[model samples]
Target: MSTPLDIASLIDRERIRPFQWTIFLLCFATTLFDGFDTQAIAYTGPAIVAAFNLAPGDLAPILIAGTLGMTIGAMTLGLVGDRVGRRPALLGGVALFSIASLATAFASGTSQILVLRFIAGLGMGGCTPVLLALAAEYGPARHRGAIMTGVLLGLPAGAMLGGLLAARMMPVIGWEGVFVIGGAAPLALLVLLWFALPESLHFLVTRAGNDQHAVRHVLARIVTWPLADDARFAVHEAAARASVAALFREGNARNTVAIWAVYFFNWIAWFMFLSWLPTVLKASGLPAAQAPLGTVVVNAVFIVCAIPLSIALPRISTRRLLIALLALGIAIAIGLAYAETSWGLVFTLAGAAGLGIGGQQIALNYLVVGAYPTTLRATATGWAIGMGRVGAIAGSAVGGTFLNMGGPGGFYLTLAVPLAAALLAVIAIRTNEPEAGTSLATAAH
Candidate 1:
């Protein structure tokens, strides 16, 4: 009998190669565009409101529409990724969002803008979980956390890009022009992804086993040596198809519940801040032109801290790290309540919150990846984040209401409550000691 080809071992033992970097960069690009389109509405909210003669509260429907689409997409499209393949699902998401963004430029009224944002959000929500799954599968077990963390950096990077682009282009191209640029750039990158990006090797060797040649081809690209023609490959999962319900089975119930709770609480607070911070800054006497810089500062520090923190996560206890970060987040929220008195203090709190809460956000994502078998990794991630989108929708809706109430202090204070709840959820979660080598193949069993 031929020895079974253990792909998990191959990736774990082999030296990191250029192909892995290529995969990481491609996923990074997908996330970058996802972030850009998601935040485009926020960055251009003032302009969109001015153009339509609307109040800040009116923007809530548009924000909630996109997040609602995200909720739907994360569950449905995420199931598509698990049932079909990550590459196609990812591409489909990119196409949907790109087209919706282009359509947003021509929206004539609130309803039209709301519909287009909902469509774009479907794609945005679907892309992120698939990207995280792919990054975990492609990266060496030792470095998977860092690679996925790096991939997620694209989110804040895209936000930073949106802020800078809006500041520069709103003058020349108008808000519609910003959407046009965001739409156009991603469409171009979509072409690059079609040609250059490979499907997840783990998915191929495991999920698409009927196509043996394709599996060998992808393996050859990542493996340092050539594969033998007769080499047999196998993933340890049972023959039954993976499904969302599987996440609740197989000793995963507690983990699934905890993961969803964390995502929901964290995103609720995070999106509320993300969606309205610029307007709040503007209300606090920052120049219309400069209000976005507060968000820019927050995103910059988030990306910077996220990169190094993810690299260090493999060496530390993720739960402890998360608790510490959430505590810091609470402290920052308190400071933010008092920050309206000074732009200097506001900027300082924003940057510090980015470092604390931002790192916790990324760490929670990494924890989710490790909590499930590979067969259901994408499904579990999608559902966790999908449910979290509900919280995000609530955040956007509530932020609008809070803004209407006319006090920045209350908005900041409300956000702290969710952060504290999420911290407690982390403290309550229990799991088998995390596997040191969390490869897709090993994770599947």
Candidate 2:
């Protein structure tokens, strides 16, 4: 008695639903937690120093501990996220970071807090790359660019939240309360995920060898489940037989290295700016009290630019877009060397830097999802990020050293080197996807 239209509606109700909003919320909450976790350490730095009667030198180990832990986490969990399922990998990351953060609240000594923060850093590292992979999987083809940007911008938003929280409550709650807040938020998210967060259908289909029930549920929520052949999907027909080694064969090797290079340089430059920017500002004549506010300006522009930047990306070629943005970033950083006391001039140059960096980040997220099969998606993304973490550590350390030696020119020049490499990497990089496309991940309901 049912017409084809009726059958189509039924399929939509049960299969291949566009995953636009569902994926967005899933990623938004996770990115918020990411921002909160990363910023907590800086916010707590002062209180910890005072409480422990610590010298600035004494704090270096604590900072290094987290970076070391994060490096390990990125490599280990990242590999696992690729081998296992992204959903489980992501959940595991959240759990590890959340528990580690909570553990910090109870620590009575610097040594104890160092271990806890390191543990949290590992988890934080695991989350970002894996989460990026997951966001790409659930999102619609056209919407991938915007969704990734929307989700990643949450990181800056989270950082801002930590700053606001510290400003308001550090007096009352101190460092312990700040970490408790960061730790507890994800615990709440874990519950919400259990009830509503669905496994990414793309991951299920490509990585888990397909499940009609899950795939259908996710799809049906969209206008209807797709009833297409295997070719419509990027998943290989031979994927069941394909190991990750397949990605390294002649067809994919150059692409892999280029991607890795891009990630490494990108993070080095990014962390250099983030870790050193305020210090650089202070040296440029801003009061110490006001120097930290420069981060607010940088991140504010970054978060604001994310939406428009991402919306624009899908329309352009990925390689072209990424290389162009990185180039612009390099130019802006050079310009900052000349920007002294002109607040308006400085902010404009700073925002230009944010624009370039923000665009590059969004493009990277897009590449993480679309460039590989769902099975290796998390792993590839994770490894790239892990390399970046290493660069961040080096960048932070070197930026500090540079600041000590000279001034703004010295600081900005240090960042310029890595960024130049990133630009070159972008040029060499090629994705499996064609030049350009669009997607706005959607659900039928």
lDDT of 1 by residue, 333-386 (tens): 888888776888888999898976666766775566567656676567657766
lDDT of 2 by residue, 278-347 (tens): 5566568765444445556667888887777666655656677787788888888787877768878876
Scanning candidate 2 in windows of ten residues, the lowest lDDT window is 1-10
What does each candidate score in C-alpha RMSD? 3.7, 6.3
Top candidate on lDDT is 1
Each model's TM-score, in the order given? Answer: 0.86, 0.73
**Candidate 1: stretches off by over 4 Å:** 202-209, 238-261, 365-386, 423-445
